[model samples]
Target chain A: MKKSWSHESKEYKIYVVLCLILGLAIAAAGLYALQKLLVPKYMRGVVEGSMIAEYYESEVPHEVLFLGDCEVYENISTVALYRDYGISSYIRGSAQQLTWQSYYLLEDTLRYETPEVVVFNVLALKYGEPQSESYNRMTLDGMRWSRSKWDAINASMTEGEHMADYLFPLLRYHSRWDELRSTDFEYAFSRDRVTVNGYYMRCDISPEGEFPAPMPLADYTLPETSMDYLTRMVELCRENDIELILIKAPTLYPYWYEEWDAQVRAFAQEYNVPYINYINLRDNIGLDMSVDTYDAGLHLNLTGAEKFADYIGQYLVNHYELTDFRDVADVARAWEDDILFYDELRDAQNAELAEYGELRSWGANAIEN
Target chain B: MNKKILSVMMASVMALSIAACASEDEDTAPVVLSGGQTAESAEGSGAQEAGETAAASADAYVFTYNGIEIRMNAPANGIIEALGDGYTYFEAPSCAYEGMDKVYTYNSIVVRSYTMDGEDYIAAVELKDDTVATAEGIRIGSTEDEVRAAYGEDGQPGTAGIEYTLGDSFISFIFENGKVVAITYTAIVG
Candidate 1:
């Protein structure tokens, strides 16, 4: 009877161990589900917020890294670069991304793989400090955990933001419980690609309206803080033997002031880097502002983006000696898939514009709540 | 056998604890007051009075000053259509104020829109010409004392105005030289 009791005890121990394992697995799954439900699914609307995070999903190595605010992401077509120049690229950009944020993003990119050229738009140089928390989250949230992400969060945090909120996003997004939609659950585990190599496509057109005249700034000089980060970006690229090119994309509305352009030009010259102001070359680049722009003059639609990309692609090829990989079967095959996606996205957006009279399924208005 | 029982009990307790925490979150979730009325009032209010008020205000702008049901980030197309087409759209020049891009004016009713992520959303609604009044009959020209009487202790005084918090919304009365210059309703969203 004592021997039977010992055997029974051993069986009980096995049962307890099995139950413990089951309980732990359930607990881990519950937490993961909760985390997924609380996070923003940028699938439906405000897709620019999803662009920065999409970079981590790319398995292919990028030869060029484009960093800037909306002007870079919206203005250049990465698909065009790949299809035409065979130069794979990614744009790490968000709305009003500050210079320091750009620097940190570049740092993060370096941690993954070093690109041959780092193209930074000078438009972000206007702001010396973090602009808004919403914009900051769009840029920072999708970044994988690393020292670079930590520094980016610290550098980009505005007043009232906490490091802990970023560490465990459930704290910040707990309030989203009431605002949850089907997309939240559907995309909890994964997200659809919002950009093709960081290019957001807009097929609709809204011609440029009369922009309010550029008001003279109290101080025309680019902020010292922004200049310091620009210097850091240049130094980082130099250390890594990556060519740093500064370009001001040709968006007419924000009024790239002559004074601001001059400051960027002087900085580029001082650093011995190439500065290309596309604003001056709009005519030469065969851009028709009336038809090319989607939202008045703020950003280029798909048409303008392709044209601009074609121009920039030629320049990148000539200046950087970038290879045309159309001959290479593997690279061409990957690009063909990307082109298919690009065509599908453009067709979908155009169809949406046709059916709805405006993009209903995709912009801010798409959020049901 | 005792040790096995204890382990099983502990696992059960842990699972229940997580469920309890989740339930607590749901229980405390902010109740979205819909259609300018609370759920309790909808069910508990006298049917006759509720029907009468609903029918009377059917065509009128359903302004709820209590709990500030006005939303700032909503598309203004519906609200503008409701307010009728006497409004003119005015674009505030670049750098006028951060985020604020345009204002729609109809008599004394003004709706301001702010640009975020390159799209416009209604940010503020103001009644400045005494053409519109709150559900409580408070208008732009109302005195501080009148506002105090209408809103009672719900409003807390700020530097230049008095703000009343209703749920996730705020109804603010801006006073200049002891007279209310504007009455604004805004809904805050994260």
Candidate 2:
């Protein structure tokens, strides 16, 4: 007669418990693999998503922290800033980063290290609400776990986005199963850094073109929600003893209105903070839009970014008591390594430009789906 | 029984996963337009089908100028041709997305178009001056009371003036000191 397994037997209970534990471990491993394969590897084409996460890998403490959207990230060269004025700076900027996102990013940065100066670009203030799920992922996914990240995600979710999706990106991008490329698998475990201290490089230039006339709005007031967040940003800077400077990057399109400018000016006056509108200082900064901008007038190219860095670095040194890192040994050594990377990147881009006349590897054409 | 319970749990997980990632594509709320006519209300008011397509064709709001039918969410090539080639054109490339947003300016009107799937669709039409008027004869410099009289109370009120939606399009009028300063027809483009 075959013996039936007894439920009360010690061996049976132990075997069942072991099986349960093994099953859970296997399930967790499978989910992790799925997540690694599904999440976007922003290695090429639309590499803006990869910029935020790369901030953690920075070795040296930055005395200046730049916060905003593409304007700061694509328009300022940190390596150039170091080279010109011996200033250590990092831009915590992402694609279309909204106002609240900037505030939260500042909050997150304070957790790791506090910079003496925090320069914020004001273009993102026009957005009152979350803009896109993709943009939210770019700004939030790379942020390390903290209350700041949690609050940022909660504030930035659009109509259909769930906290679970942000928690397990596999939940949001599981539809990307069929769209997986070789980069997804290759970068599943590790990622290549795409920015030089938060500066996205574009070597090829598209000369400035005539922009559309600014359309009149029903109401010119910046969204109240955005303004509130801006107020919070100011208060946060005060608490951290960080000097905050507001800037309007010199992009011709996405037209900055005079009415909006007046409001920001008034706010700056009220707060006793300095506001610099680069549009007015374009000529002084020596930016010839014809050669300086890459993608028409939306952003500056490598040449333009370097000039901007030189100009801003001069301003920063003149105004603040900043440390000239070139005098410091360890910091200088680290910056030397960064300079090498920057030179190599510029050389590679220039080579591609010389070969194709247009960037087939970096700009709009290099976008991988 | 154990196998059955496990099957049920797996099915629930699959269902919950899909529910969590629900698609955000469809926008089916009824659009209310000027003169108190809605896509829903127009059905009872003897509106006829205007296009071959079934969705929103019958009730899509169109702005007419210089004997041309300018429509939101419709191809702008034919309308541009009808209005002639004397337009000041400007193009802005999308930041992270594909395609360019193109603007064409005529004498009294400005037409803006956006590209999707490699095709240009009319995104907005702005009446640049008092020379241009809506089909209901509302133009720049018209009083806010005139707008209330023509569009009735069904229009949505904003900080500037009232906005009326018809299908995938909306007409917004900007008023300052009880007079209309600007008028625009826009499409709710994805």
Q: What i-RMS does each candidate reach, in Å?
A: 10.7, 10.0
* TM-score (all chains, Cα) for each model: 0.69, 0.86
Residues A249-300, candidate 1: write the lDDT tens digits. Answer: 9887666889888889899999999999998899978888788987777788
lDDT, model 1, position A332: 76
Q: Cα lDDT for residue B99, model 2?
A: 50
Can you write out model 2's per-residue Cα lDDT over A151-184, one digit (the tens) per residue? 9999999887778777777667776766777888
Q: For residues B51-106, what per-residue lDDT tens digits would candidate 1 score against the true structure?
A: 43234443223353222233455544434444556767656322201243566776
Clashing pairs in 1: B67-B166
The TM-score of candidate 1 is 0.69
Count residue pairs with overlapping backbones in model 1.
1
